[model samples]
Target chain A: MKHPPLLQAKNLKYSFNETGTSTHVLNDVSIELFPGEITSIVGPSGCGKSTLLYLLGLLDRPDSGEISLNEKDVLKCDDKKRTILRNHKLGFVFQFHFLIKELSVLDNVALPMRKAGKSKTASYEKARDVLGKLGLLDKSNRFPHKLSGGEQQRVAIARAIINSPSLILADEPTGNLDTENSKKVHSVLSKLAIEENISVLIVTHNLELAQSCDRVIKMRDGRIIE
Target chain B: MAMSLIGIVLGIAFFVITQAQTSGFEAFFIRTILGTNGAIKISDRFQDMDGTVSKVSKDGNFQFFFRSREEAQYTEGIRFPDEIRNALASYQDITGISEVLEGTAELAGSSRSFPVIFQGIRYHDHSQVSELNNQLIAGAIVDFAKDPMSILVGNRIAERLMLKIGDRIVMKGGTGTLQLRIAGVFETGVSQIDKKRIYIHLSTARQFKGERFAGSFFQLALDNPDKAPELAAQIQYHLGHRSVSWQEREKVWLDVFKALRISSAITVSSILLLSGLGIFNVFAIMVIEKTRDIAILRSMGFSRFDASAVFLWQGLIILFLGVLLGSFFGFLSTYFISEIPLRIRGIFSTDSFVVNWDVFHYLWAISLASVFVVIATWVPARRAGKIQPAKIIRETL
Candidate 1:
């Protein structure tokens, strides 16, 4: 039996205009992320790697594109419908580990679950189990600011996966970490794709991190080269 | 947040203090006047007489008195005093009725002559309606009622003339002059009453005015003073005399008090409004500082409404806390301020500042705070909600 990729984007295009000067950011970019595969997008700065990920994660709109999650077209969804799809099907990890300073680590992780209409107990128990898997259960009560950069990034990963989404989209998730912390975050994302059969797509400048992934999409200017 | 909360607290405290002081002044004045005037009075421009008392040319106080009989005589004021009194006597709402003979007279002391208002009454009937008897500081209350020539003098009047009880003074009125002895001196705390008013027997006042069966007005005290206006109207319709409620007689003072009320309300509301502006600034800065956090939450599936709600809750929580603390401080300030002794003398007298500790003032303070905060919070919350996660997320990338 043959099956389609878990997430796919075809001929995605986006542009930004500055005072009547048009700059094309993404051009005819097509890519597929399969289940149980850790895929990485490698590019230089301003290479549209993050833009393509944003379009795939439904965080942004493309000038023209065909995007599908489990064979359902996502490009046609409205802001509200796109948000629901993002909540239920797509998880995101930004570079900064943008955990809310006002909330404790456990609350930050459980926020997505709570937003998904899960019970408080169910969300907290799930969040606690995930934090324990990351060896961070004991530190769940601490605020994000008190934690080191690597721990905060791991907490961000826990938050991303708490909704149990099929696809995890991480944009340079460990770009700010030292080698040790970067290895830690890379191992967590690889484990999420392999152990949980989740489709992981990462955009990063780390060549080793990209090469260790199941697939790597290289890009220049606006179009994917491989 | 602290600054805004402090603003609210100070505003409410000032409001509480001002409201209490204004109300205290008004109450003190009204109470002092009511002690002398009763709750309602029925007065007629024309004197009660035989035949007809006609308006000669109707200006201010111009009137023509005509007697039909060859041997002419003048009767009392108020066309049907007996009928009016008899009609009002049985009403359950009416507590007491005193026939009043009020006119200005000259008191010629041996050394000084002072102009005074002579208020004549049947002592027992007047005592039931007023606090005059209780205000008698010296001499006997009986002398003013029992002896035709005996009068109750105000303390200020007696002091000005250097006259004491049993001192004979000549009272000159429109009719004639007569020798009257001061029997009592009263102090009402209010300077106007103590300086310009004197009480005498109704018969003596009539004799001094050279009119028998004459009454200037009837002072009626009701069991419920709040019903004065309605009762006054009813009594006026029945007796065909002009009636005035206690509130009506003090309309000028009430107008001035209303202005004070408006000014106080403006003061409180403006302070609350400024507090709200402070809250708005605080929340706006928080939203801007946490722009990336808001973006991350939205990326984590928090909808715009949810993002907005976070700030809304923050604002509401601050408002609730501020109002709670403000109310406590406001009440405490009122208590402390009311404890201060203030002896104020004007149209009325007060030994201390009067304050109304009505719970409604607290409720009003809270409501005002809520209104301002909600308005203050909405703008920042809406701005926070409108922030596109993609814009911030892309910037961070």
Candidate 2:
């Protein structure tokens, strides 16, 4: 049975204006994300894959496009609502493992929950359990710099899911990881997407990683190569 | 490198000096006013108003005016001259005692109008007359005498009136009028006192008032200048017998200190605002420099508010370090300038710029300087909130 799409984008267009000359970044790109599945977005360099992801994540708006989370038309949602959706419904992982180094691992993981108004003890306990599941329970109190590259990426994974987001959007998360770390991360992502029935989108040029996903969407010159 | 060090050094020094200036005045006011007057005053402040006061015994001989004789003994570390001497040896903190004396027109020369402070003084021990002289801009101090009419004129008044010693100046008091001769002209460093205040003999003060009266309510010097309220309390306890420390009895020196403080506060705040703004600019730039870090936090589920809080916290941490260090050196600078290794008085009694550990003062200066830190911290905190995590992440990736 094909249920409603968990993440939807329609006819998104974006351009960057430099000194009055328009550089068309994303032209008529559209994609849909569904629950209980992984969609790997494979694109050539500068193909606007990250740009589309940003728009879908409500991190930026396009020249003309509509995005919806579940059945809610999120393009019409106010800024506060967008922030709420981003904070609760959407979890993001970057290639750089952009964990705030100043914060302890548990704090970085618990951050979204804290923003969602979770009580301190509950947020801490939830983050701790997630860290434990990610095998970072012993490293919870350690700062990000102290963790190995693999452990740090794992911490980032625990952080994204700690808020129990319905959609996880990772932009080349394993791009900076070695093969072993990348495989370890893929296992974490695939297992969480399947077990929690959460929608997952990974943007990458790594063919092996892309080929392993349930479906691969290839892009060239900012349009889907259907 | 020199400019940076100068900025930091001068910034710290200016902050400390200006802060010390304001702090000193505030400290002095509390000491002089709070000590001289009670911690809080309950007085018929308005001239014709029945304000909150005078619940004491209403014996016709008992007025609201009184002083604590115990202060003198407690401070002298000696028993007051005898209880008889104590009874006669009063402690006075009078503003000015004016009397009208109707005397013979026996002066054969000049009859000039002179402003005189006819302090109804009985002895030197009680009337801290030297304090009046401490305010002298010029001229010598006169000894208190038993005779009537002989007095001292401030230098400015003497110069303005063009009259020296041996010239006669007449004054009218609240009671009878008095005629006094300028046996000597004394200048208290205070130009106001040098030009205006006149010291008249106590006998003449009584002669003008039509009775033989001793001023138990004259200007007094406290044992502990810092604990004036304690002195006032002891006065009420011991001398419920004599006088009151109302607004009327404060000396010119106290007012001078107050005016100095108000002006210093305004001046220091302006200077601090500029320096603080510089500090703020630096810190804001620091936040901007750490733009990537801030964006990473925001992108990692931290809201704009959380990012701002982190910056503000960092700025506060910087302020804590700078201010704590500045205060230590500010204090050290004050002490160093005071000792000057050469006994030199820099601009504005630079002596006060350096001081021993004064809690009331150090705390005030440090806190005032911290307000700038808050403003400095606030700018950067706000800048942190304006950061776009999405934009930053896109740029980095």
Candidate 3:
């Protein structure tokens, strides 16, 4: 049986204008994100993996490309609508958790729902369910700073999936973690993708992490090489 | 939110109390003056007019008899109720309401004699209307109702004559030279009134002026001192003529107080404005420092509005504290300065205490200043919102 990708990036291009020069960061980048699969985009340090993640999360506008989320072009939506779509349909995990230190762990998990204007009770219940799934129910009220590296990454993962998004894009989510913590994060991500039928595209430098993904796509200047 | 609310209430308490005290004191002064004196007054050009504007005005002192028919008619003119009758019968406020008298007096020392115009006031009524309680320094007020012949001298009069209380002074009036004893002396702080005041009983004053029913001015003590202006208004209405108020009678002093009020306003505004600017600077620095926190909030699904709100909250908190602390310091400042003797090297002195504790002026000053602070905070808070979350996250990380 054949199925369409949950997200399709076709002819994705980006550039930064630097004093009358077009600094091309990405060119003709294309990939497929399918449900229950982990795709790793591996490259050198400044090869625009994070830029690609920013584009995928709709945090930045591409110079030219098509980002189809669930078969609809994301670039066509208004800012407010785009934000709503981002909160509802796409999950993002950054290198740093970027977790609001002031908010509780449960509140961090419930953030997307709160952004989506859900009631407090519904957001809290949804937050608890996701936290419990991540085996963090006991620590829901604790703040992110109170948690360790691997546990915080898991909490970040819980936060990412709290709104039941179709695709999760992690920009080196475990980049700061040690080998042991990174493996622990990888297992949890793999379990989440398989059991929840969610797709994940991770940008990582570690060849071992890439090898463990369902499919590994290598990039040098921006073009994907499978 | 609850904790934040507690902070706000505490801040408002510090705000409102200082505001009220300043306001209450201003009210007290304005009340004190307006109580003893009326708010407004109308007087004739020539202050010594009897009922009509007669060109040949009798001097402030004279003497004589009135026609019996005129006296009988004059006595029949006035009527009163029991409450009013009882107060007037006892002559509590009025030592005596009498007549204006003119005299030439000799200075006891320096032997310089000059013609002086004097009015024999019911001395008790003089104190009731004069606000002598606020007198800077005083000897004794005269007992005119008890001793019809005794007299009180005005501050300027006493100064010029070089006389104090318990001085026997001889004055040549229209009929003869009458010897009167000086009972007490008072200063009204107004130049004109303090220059030429002389008091005796209402009957003696009429006797000195020489007309029983003829008087230079109407001198009646109010039934109640607090209700003087109201009663004055009623009497003026009954008389259906242009009448004079004591405030108009003492315009120079009123003008002085008015000037005092204006200067106080200017001083308070300058101080509050400077304090507000200092607070605004504090808030500006605070927002700049919290830029990263605001960016994190924006990234955490908070809209630009929420981020701005967070900054605004920080501003409001700081301003609330500043207003409180500033007012607290302002009070302690005023009191501390007051505590140190006001007449420091004779350079500074005040009516009562620091700018006479004006409430409305200070509150208006503070509110105007704080509004500027609030507006000033907006620039920084909006700048905070403009900070990009990803850029901040990248930069901070």
In terms of DockQ, the best-performing candidate is: 1
**What DockQ does each listed candidate score?**
0.63, 0.29, 0.24
- Model 1: colliding residue pairs: B48-B77, B76-B213, B76-B214
For model 3, give the TM-score of chain B: 0.61
Tell me the lDDT of candidate 3. Answer: 0.63
Give me the runs in candidate 3 sitting further than 4 Å from their true place: A1-12, A19-21, A28-32, A64-68, A71-78, A101-107, A110-129, A136-147, A215-226, B1-152, B155-168, B172-196, B199-293, B320-362, B394-397
Ranking by TM-score: 1, 3, 2
Ranked by lDDT from best down, the candidates are 1, 2, 3
Tens digit per residue, CA lDDT, model 2, A1-226: 8978998888888988789999887888888889989999998898888988888888778889778889789988866677778888888888988787779998988988888899999999999999988888999999999989999999988988988999999999999999999999998999999999999999998999999999899887778885
Per-residue accuracy of model 1 over B90-192 as CA lDDT, tens digit each? 7789898999888889999998799999988899999888888778889988887778789999888999999898999999876889898899998777787
The Cα error of candidate 2 at residue B385, in Å, is 1.6
Greater lDDT among 1 and 3 belongs to: 1
DockQ winner between 1 and 2, please give it: 1
Order of candidates by DockQ, top first?
1, 2, 3
- Worst 10-residue lDDT window, candidate 1 chain B: B46-55
Clash total of candidate 2 = 34
DockQ score for model 1 = 0.63
lDDT of 3 by residue, A32-80 (tens): 7899898898989778787787787776778998998889888888766
